[model samples]
Target: AFFITYTYPRTAVSFSEAMDWTPGQLSGNFLLPSILEPGQTYNVRARLETLEDPTQETDTDWGVITIPEAPPEVPPAADIRNLDFGAAGGTYEIGER
Candidate 1:
């Protein structure tokens, strides 16, 4: 006597708490590195752990995010020097030249 076997692939996720975040958008803020350096590539991915089967969890496609460099800090502007303005009706007109 002989026996036959059949196998099928899983098509759905089991009961578990998971998150589905929209691409190119931020749902909320999460803990980030204390200091994030600029001009660097970081690996980003979303995961969904299965309650029934830990090994059969789901993971989003891996993503590469490049950090941007911080803009240069500008110094405060200097104050205007002596601005001589004659009296209301004096010789030197305020709006002249």
Candidate 2:
């Protein structure tokens, strides 16, 4: 099983669900939580479970992981040109427009 921890503001979460596995099963997939934000680093580690011997050391060394920051927002293009609004002829006032 794997665990995830965020240092600042103090949050900890489990990465995988409990499963029944056959002997000799080696690898499996894990899904990351959607609540994780970009530009923040997280700590991860794996733990072993033993059915036969419960007293063994189960935890691995902590590893660092991070998601890259999201891209910047694009600014809109200058659509309207320098037209003279002083030449007002319509019924609408200058403040109304």
Candidate 3:
């Protein structure tokens, strides 16, 4: 059997106090009173502290928390036509492309 563990940093320096995750089956998803500001970045970290037996304790893993970017100013439907199909189709042959 296994259990979920959720943890994060105690302080907020570059980011606001609010942060969250998306929909799925896992750990660390919570709603906040405020939304993240535009053009900002945040970093959060967590670890799993586990006990294999009554006498032994261990930290299984650690991970950085991700806060997804905000939606673009234009809606999907409105910007669908403006998409450049030529650039998206991988037709450009260059050093990087």
The TM-scores of all predictions, comma-separated, are 0.31, 0.33, 0.29
Per-candidate clashes come to: 0, 0, 0
lDDT of 1 by residue, 11-92 (tens): 3433325454444432333444534445654555554456577687555565523334443445668665866666565586
Instruction: Put down candidate 3 lDDT per residue, 1-97, tens digits, no spaces.
Output: 5533344343312322352323333435544324445786544444433333424432322244455655445444655666765435557557874
Give RMSD to native, each candidate. 19.4, 11.3, 16.0
**How does model 3 fare in lDDT?**
0.43
With a 3 Å backbone cut-off (N, CA, C), the pairs that clash in candidate 3 are none
The global C-alpha lDDT for each of the candidates, from Candidate 1 onward, is 0.47, 0.49, 0.43
| Candidate 2 residue pairs in clash (backbone atoms < 3 Å) | none
Best by lDDT: 2
Ordered by TM-score, highest first, the candidates read 2, 1, 3
